[model samples]
Target: MKFFTCSVIMSVFLQVCSQNPLRYWTLLPNILVVEVNGSLGQQPLSCLGSPQEGTRKDDKSQGIIWRKNGVVEEQRGNSYLVQLEESLGGGNYTCHREDGSLVNHTVVLIQEDQTERRKILVKTDQEDYLTCLAQNYNGEFHCSWTWNRNRVGKVALIQVGRISNDSDAQCSVDVSTQRWTCSSGQSNFSCSVDEHGHRISCRDEQHCPYAEEIQQIYVTLYVRTEQFLVENYSKQFYLAEIVKPDMVRISEVNTSMIEWSYPSSWSSPYSYFPLTFQISQFRRGCKGCDNPCTESKPAKTLMVHFTDVCQFKVKHKAKAVCVRAKDALCNSQWSEWSHLRLRRNNKNKHRQNDKQG
Candidate 1:
């Protein structure tokens, strides 16, 4: 019975593939996918509707017509040019010969500019684990994101560019490994999705630290699952702006004081990539507490010099303590707070009181 079900499923899959029109067209070698973009008057859409290559022996005798949104716009031309504002320029553009046979069809999507799609990069608490990080101005960076719980998806496409419209870029995937590779005029890189297809990691080849302010990395990821669901997520950022340091670890050095050190993964020689420490005291029971960092009236904020182990006396009689850190220079984002439990030693307290007496 199982074998029969498997065979029936395979037959249905092949039948669906045969019914798809683009399936066979995409297999043809040397097929051209023409793309164009334009603004109001600065850029106009002048596109050729015929194949650039291959001989058209009857072209001289046949007349061509171009139409935008099913309305005839041009009567004769090998290439059609639109000299209108971009807002009035987008439509289903088609080309035909005098014989009333369709020669080509192209979809013109008009936009103010390419960066319009970059507004989706805002961070939110619901975001699972989507993050893009780079330590230096070097051309190498990594982007990783996770999906909502119980939702599974695989990366079907990856696009990267400085502008939004330059998305003609392509990425090749390794099915066995789920890794992706893409290259552009100014960037070259590869990425890999995890086994569950919820996480991605990328490396940039042409990244450079020069002109950091003017440079930005724009990324778009298309994900699809077995249920035929598709989604696109996009983000844009500069390397330095998103460089988040890992959480600092705090440990008790003595009864009177606690010490903390930088995360092991942070940039080397601590002198350069220093981090500031923010210590917040929390009692066993607190009402309407703000975030651990801001819970106290005035957080005990201290600047820890690079390359130094930070030590601060725990003067508060609070039951618990929380410590977090952030980059000293940019102060971009804070790391996760580390919690410590205080074990009050009454013997030591008595000894200090006796000495005072």
Candidate 2:
């Protein structure tokens, strides 16, 4: 009789898979993520029990109790069938023994509707849902995302590690600090979510500025909506690629001399992570003087400064002076131009005109 029951269960499982085809992943320890196509109708979720219970998910128990999103529900056997409609059909399903001891839990997520359905989060202007940046190479970075107008959600999980060696990475969270930590052989990272749930900040404690980085960091954030719909957004980058130096402070020592320093957030020893500076001085009546001009503007400048001590000398006073910096050692992005508008005094103006005459 038991053999006959196993055969019937196998037949039904294969039949379900054949229709919609299922893909699942173990998001955390016993937390499973099941992806299904909403248009495909119903899908079956098997109770993958704990390691000690049995190896196969189809193993028999002393009867099972089912619950949907923490509330008990009537579900027979070891499998619970869920419809494949959008949020209406999605939920967190768990099965326990008749004694109420837990077995396993699965969170069902519907894929972007192939025909007419939409995803939980919309793409941003940059064409991606996630964006990350680093102020320096101190093994720290922050990633942010835009929430969909109607389907706001929270981060369900975060995974970060070096490329090709992240399979064993483990992540845990601290309730008190609301911070998360992911540790692996190569590095240890701590991350925290912002109050608005739109941004996450992370830091690597063991990062070395001098060490050669042959590997890249890969990060994935799993976000879920109130309806139990989850989506994962991932990004891979090297520290140098996303390194954006802070604005340089340009101070006027004298009319002819302008002095500036490295951004305080930059990595130290200035020589090791040197920066290249560009100084531009705009003349009066220039049409583009209203905004910060890029290097393409009609400006005369040279990449001269490569240390913490940055200074530029002006032969004549002009409308404004702008300064920007970029990583001298790497082909990275330049910082925003720091502009200082110059106002010529009438006395100095008369003196200059007399000298010119």
lDDT of each: 0.57, 0.75
Q: What is residue 60's positional error in candidate 2, in angstroms?
A: 13
lDDT score for candidate 1 against the true structure: 0.57
Candidate 1, residue 65: the lDDT equals 78
Among these predictions, the greatest TM-score belongs to 2
Candidate 2 residue-wise lDDT, 217-305, digit = tens: 88898888888777888899899998989999878777677888899999998988899888776664345545655533534666775
- Write down the TM-score for model 2: 0.77
Error at 80, model 2, angstroms: 3.4
Lowest-sum lDDT 10-residue window in model 1: 20-29
User: Between which residue pairs do clashes occur in model 1?
Assistant: 114-164, 139-207
Model 1 Cα lDDT, one tens digit per residue, 53-86: 2125335423667787678884455555543342
